[model samples]
Target chain A: SAVISQKPSRDICQRGTSLTIQCQVDSQVTMMFWYRQQPGQSLTLIATANQGSEATYESGFVIDKFPISRPNLTFSTLTVSNMSPEDSSIYLCSAECSGNTIYFGEGSWLTVV
Target chain B: SQQGEEDPQALSIQEGENATMNCSYKTSINNLQWYRQNSGRGLVHLILIRSNEREKHSGRLRVTLDTSKKSSSLLITASRAADTASYFCAPFSSNTGKLIFGQGTTLQVKP
Candidate 1:
């Protein structure tokens, strides 16, 4: 099992500002992903944080808005740039471990003011 | 497109009662996974059932997958107030190598 931890558990930022959420895994993981959950909504995959390369983003999400950095197998970071009220949401970091089970970190709660 | 839509958008049940949530997908999948989130917090993986498997159990949680019907169900028996949360089903398609999430079922277990 992998223990994934995230930082900045809760924060309120001003519009136009950016916030970076950090994720650290206890063990090396092959796959790491970022997801967003807006108010009263389910999670939506933001991007796949790939180590040593650019992240793979899903449709409706772009690198310019959500830049991701996976420096190693155990650490990754996601930045929500040029934030807006629409960007206020819970950002989650997850890693697929134990073959089939995926573990998630206690998400970062960001509220844009 | 490996997402599953959850049924009964919201459910309200008393403590000790059983809560069942259903998910239906549009395409075939290799496996189906269930996750829970409390008060919009991070997700906790509850259980996973492979397409070939019919049923799986973990503690008070039971998951059943019916590939022929392209649907799955999650049953939480003897639920408690702590079990009040949103439940989601993620269908994994080997073709995409990822899981897509749909709007989840919000279960409110009243104490």
Candidate 2:
């Protein structure tokens, strides 16, 4: 399995400020997924980041609010824009490996006050 | 509604006892996987059961998949206090790596 690392493990930002979380994988992968877990909630798929293309967002997520960028196969970034208190949650990134297994990053915890 | 949903959102058991968590999905999946999350940390992959496989085991964890019913169950034998965590089932196998995680079952194993 591939090892994933996420930057800014935890952060506190003021409302209306945006924060970008970065995810890096040890090896190049074809697809990277971003997920959001609100306090006391399950993980929700935010978007799919594929290198060299626009990200595919889930129904409730918008590119403007949660913009994603995957400049290459091994790295991707998710930015929470125009943040609000409601945006406080844990953001995680995962990469798919051989045998259909997925590995997750430590996750970035964001708090909008 | 999410594709995968887990039953008994929370569970409590005694150490050395067995713990079981069930998950049901709405769509056909190529494979199902179980993951464990400790408190506020990232998820750790526990086991993966392919659609064609009935059961799989890893260490103290056992996972069973029933494609006919679109459901899966995770069993932890000889449960320990360290097993207390949120267990989630993810539907993987689609060409897209994006996975739909179930609501998850919070298991608390009292020592």
Candidate 3:
């Protein structure tokens, strides 16, 4: 199991502003992923952050809206650009460790007003 | 679109009883995993059952998979109030390593 930490556990931002969430893992991981959970809904994969490369985004999500950066193997960041009220959701970062099991950060809850 | 769907959106059970949640997926998967999440927190991995395996267990949690039907079930025995949380079943595609999560079953264990 990996000990993962995410900054800005909860934040309230004004519409049109941007919020960047940080994810730090205890050790180097093979892959890192970002997910969004809307209230009362299932999680949606936003993108996969690969170290030293551009993030790979899923369908219905674009790089412009959710830009990601992975400076190293143990750290990654997801920035929600030009945010709106609809963008309010809990953003979670996860990493795949040994045994094909994935561990998640505590999550950053963002509320866009 | 989501690959898996869990049955019984919500469930209320008494402590010491057993709670079971079912999940059905759309495509082939290398493995299926169950996760638990407390309110406003990240998900915690519970157990993983591979496509070749029928069942797996960890502590008090048991998971069974049926690849022919593309479905799975999670059973929590001797439930406790601390077990109250949302349970999700995720299937991983070996080709992508992306886990597709289900809607989740919210279980409330009453003490």
Candidate that scores best on lDDT = 3
User: How well does model 2 score by local distance difference test?
Assistant: 0.91
RMSD of 1: 1.2
lDDT for each residue of candidate 2 in B28-91, tens digit (9 for 90 to 100): 7888888999999999988889999999989898889998988999999999999999999888
Which is better, 2 or 3, measured by lDDT? 3
Residue pairs with colliding backbones in model 2 are none
Instruction: Give the lDDT of residue A53 in candidate 2.
Output: 88
| Better structure of 1 and 3 per lDDT | 3
Evaluated on the second chain alone, the candidates' TM-scores are 0.97, 0.94, 0.96
Please report how far candidate 2 places residue B79 from its true position, in Å.
0.8
* Overall lDDT per candidate, in order of appearance: 0.91, 0.91, 0.92
- Candidate 1, residue A109: how far the Cα is off, in Å: 0.4
Write one digit per residue (lDDT tens) for candidate 3, span B5-84. 99888999999999999999888888888899999899998898889999998999989999999999999999999999
True lDDT of residue A8, candidate 3: 90
- Pairs with steric clashes in candidate 3: none
Model 1 lDDT tens row, B1-111: 578899989999999999999999999888899999899578888888988999999999999999998999999999999998889999987677677899899999999
Candidate 3 residue B67 Cα shift, in angstroms, is 1.6
- DockQ of predicted candidate 1: 0.82
Candidate 2, residue A6: lDDT: 99
Indicate the TM-score of model 3. Answer: 0.96
